[model samples]
Target: MKLDVLALSGVFDTGLATVLDTLATANELAAAQGWRTQPFDVRVVGLRRRVRTALGLQVPVQPAEVANGAVADWLVLPAIGAKMPPGLIDALATREVREAAAHLRERHAAGTHIAAPCIGGFVLAESGLLDGHDATVSWWLGPLFRERYPKVRLDESRMLVASGAFVTTGAAIAHLDLALWLVRQVSPELAAVTARYLVVDTRPSQAPYVIPDHLAHSDPLVARFELWARQRLAEGFSLDVAASALATSPRTLQRRIEAVLGRSPLGYVQDLRVERAVHLLRTSRVDVEVIAAEVGYANAVTLRALLRRKLGRGVRELRARG
Candidate 1:
């Protein structure tokens, strides 16, 4: 497959390297196994010949003018290194990003598979290709993603989602997952061999690592609700009571919460409780029943069920991992 990795200015250096290096390693590992791996002609193409990363690392990139003319089977967009909203805004408005977005649109029109992971998903989203597709972004960027691209169905919970030719994954290291997945698309055995060599464990969901505090802070109402929820965590939550205490009606609370966080108020509270339970399970020797109560569940039975439903693991299983 002819693949081009778009290396833009202010790009996160590690994310760009992860996809390029992992694919190269996959080819090597597959050959070691006496298997015929898919041919990957991966090139690091950029808007300029030399681009400075967010950390000011000087990276030599093939002039995008050159690769822009080459037909590619896949175009990979790596994450940008803007953590704050203003930085994200500025990065997206940069000349490199605009040029890259235009190229991505062209590639999609030509039927190239668009693969992006982490904050790079923003570029894909900007191209309007992800419209009406099940997509995901870096977990913390969920609200911004949804707000900026309303046409796309953004699910922050997934680490990987393949919708037709467009494949996206969540966060930094998922770039490796995307690479291995592309390998798996060619040959499952090759992906297996590459994964073993790299000690890359395949993780399906981003649920375990999502920090509610970080996501909530993006919206003042959500942040206020988070504080209120944590204070009453041991006592459980009532939507009506919460609305009254927060000086909002149940209808307004539900609407804003759903619009901003893409989850109901109840769901948000549950996330807080589950996060609390996970920490307690990992650090404390508390019994499951007591932990459940501490997290606002009436009993261990319900908490265990919720844990299985939300985390895909039972209480004992989570404890075992800890």
Candidate 2:
């Protein structure tokens, strides 16, 4: 498979290295294992001939203008160095990002499959190709992404999401997951072998790692609701009561929460419950039943199901990690 890895100035060092290393390993393992999978022909392409990573490491790249009219089968975009909303917004308005977005739009028009991980999704969204597609971004940037690209269906909870020809992954480290997914497209066996060699485990959801409080603080109303929700966790959630406390109608409260957090009020409440339960399980040696009750669950069974659904792990795993 022919692949072009887009290298932007101030790109995330780990994100770029992860994609390059994973694909290189896949190629090596496929050949060494005598597998019949097609080898990945990867090249680092950039708008300029010389690009520097976030940590000031010089990256040698082939200028996109001199690609000799070659169209790659896939174009992989790693996250940029901008780690926060303000910095990311500033970076997006620069000439480099605008040019890259234009170049990406042209590539997509020419039938190149695009994969973006972490804040790379911001660039892809800027290109407008993901406007009507389902995609995922770094969980912490969920609110900003939603505000900037309202047309795109953003699901920050998932580790990876594929829609049409675009595949987006959550967080910086998910670059590895994106690379493995590409290898799987060629040969699932080869992908598995590559993963095992790299000692990388599959992470299906970003929900387990997301900090709800951080996202909630993005909007004042959401922040207030979060505080109220925490106080009511052990007492059970009542939307009407919550709205009354916040001096708003239930419908208005639901709208505000959904617009800010991309989930209903009750959904956010459940997230708070899960967060509390996890904390209790890790910090204290409390029984599952007691913890569940503290988190507003009626019984241990309900909490167990919730933990497995949200975290993809049982109480035992959480305790062991604790």
Candidate 3:
């Protein structure tokens, strides 16, 4: 496949490398297995011929025109890294991002398939290509994405979402999933072999890894609630109590949270509890029961079940890795 890795300015260095190197590795594995899969004809392209990544690494890329003229069967958008929310907001409004959206619109109109990982989805969404189409973005950016692109059905929970011509993945590392998906589309057999060689596990969703605390700062009411929730996580506070603490009506509190965070108050608190439980599990040498109680769970059994159901991990397994 003729693939163009469209690296915009301020792109995440790791994301660009991940897509290119993983696909190259997949090709090598297929060749070793004597499979006759067509190798990926991948070129890194940018709005400009060159750009600096967020880490200040200089990367050379083909001019935008290189992606045209049937040279590209698929256009890949890698995530851009921004240190702060303001940084991301600034990036989305930049000429580089807008040019990327325009280029993607043109390419899609010309029948080129589009695949974007994490924040790259913003570029595609800006083009209106994902309008009325189901898409996925980094879970932490869920609120901003929904606010900016309401017409596009945003499913931030999914690890990957494929809506016809477009394929989008969540989380920064989801480029791994996107690469495997692409490899599979060409040859499931090769994809299997490649995955085995790479030890790429099947990750179905980004929900478990989402940290509500980090996302709460986007809205003031939510931020205040997050502070209150964290203080009372072990005690368990009711929604009405939380609203009163924040000096807002329960219904309005719910409304503000739902509008920005896309999570119910209950869901938000549960996620908070789980996130704290995970930290204790990974960093603490204490018993599971103690850790569970510390996170407001009554017992280890409940926490264990939540870990398994949400993160697809066991207590023993998490500790061993930690």
Candidate 4:
């Protein structure tokens, strides 16, 4: 497979390196293991002839237009260094990034499979190709992405989401996952071998790593609701009561929470409860049943099911990891 790694200026250093290293390792392992599939032909393409990473390291890159002529089978966009919304917005508004987005749209039109991880999802969304597609971004950027690209179905809880020809992954390190997924497309065996050699494990969901409070604070109403929810974790969540306490109607409260967090009020409470349960499991030697009660679950069974649903892990696994 021919792949073009689009390296934007001020790109996340680790994200770029992970993509290159993972694909390079796959190529080596494919040949060494005598795999029938051909090795990936990868090149770093950029808006300019040279660009610097967030850390000021200069990288030589082939002109993006040159790569456009070759029609790479895949175009991978690594996260840019704009870690925050304001910085990311500023970066996206620049001439270079807009040009890059235009280039991305062109590539997608020409039948290149597009993949981005972390803030690179922002670029894909900017190009408008992710519209009407199920995608994911860095969990912390979930609110911004949803608000900015309302047409795209944003599921930040997923570690990776593939929709048609566009693939998106969560956070900076998910670049490895994206690369492994691409390798899997060619040869699942080679992908597994590459992952084992790189000491990388499959992370299917970003839910376990999400800090609900961080996302909640993006909206004042959501932040207030989060505080209220945490204080009442041991109590049954009542949307009417919460709305009354917060000086809003239940309908308004529901709309705001759904709009801001992409989940209903009760769902956010469930998230809070799961987060608290995980914390208690890690920090306290409390029994599972007691911890479950503390987090508003009726019994250990209920909490276990919830943990498995939200985190894809059991209490024992969470405790061990903690």
Q: What is the C-alpha RMSD of each candidate to the true structure, in Å?
A: 1.9, 1.4, 2.9, 1.2
Tens digits of lDDT, candidate 2, 1-322: 9999999999999999999999999998888988666489898999977899999999999877527787799999999999999999999999999999999999998889999999999999999999999999999999999999999999999999999999999998999999999999988998999999999897999998999999999999899999989987988688999999999999999998888789999999999999999999989999999998898988999999999998899999998888
List model 1 lDDT by residue over 1-322, tens digit each.
Answer: 7888888888898898888888998777767767665467787888877887878898777865435466788888889899667889888887777778888888888778999899989988888889999998888889999899989898898899999889999989999989999888877887888898888798888888899989888889889998999999998578999999999999998988888888899998999999999999988889989998888888999988888878888767887888
The model with the greatest lDDT is 2
Clashes of each: 0, 0, 0, 0
The local distance difference test score of model 1 is 0.86
Candidate-wise lDDT, in order:
0.86, 0.93, 0.85, 0.92
* TM-score, per-candidate, Cα-based: 0.93, 0.97, 0.85, 0.97
- Give the TM-score comparing model 1 with the true structure, all chains together: 0.93
Q: What lDDT score is found at residue 253 in candidate 1?
A: 86
Off by over 4 Å in 2: 35-38
- List model 4 lDDT by residue over 293-322, tens digit each: 888989999999989999999988989987
Displacement of residue 45 (Cα, Å) in model 2 is 0.4
lDDT, residue 299, model 2: 99
Runs in model 3 with CA error above 4 Å? 55-60, 66-71, 155-157, 199-202, 235-237, 283-301
Report how far residue 105 has shifted in candidate 3, in Å.
1.6
Decide which is better by TM-score, 2 or 3: 2
TM-score of 4: 0.97
Question: Tens digit of lDDT per residue, candidate 3, span 1-322?
Answer: 8888888888998889989988898778868877676478788887886788989999988786753356578999999997345778888899888888889988888788999998899888989999999999998888888888888888787899999999999988898899989888888887887788888785998976787777888888899999999888888658899888889999999988877877688778888888888888779899998988888889999999988877788898888877
By lDDT, the better pick of 2 and 3 is 2
* Model 4, runs deviating above 4 Å: 35-38, 66-69
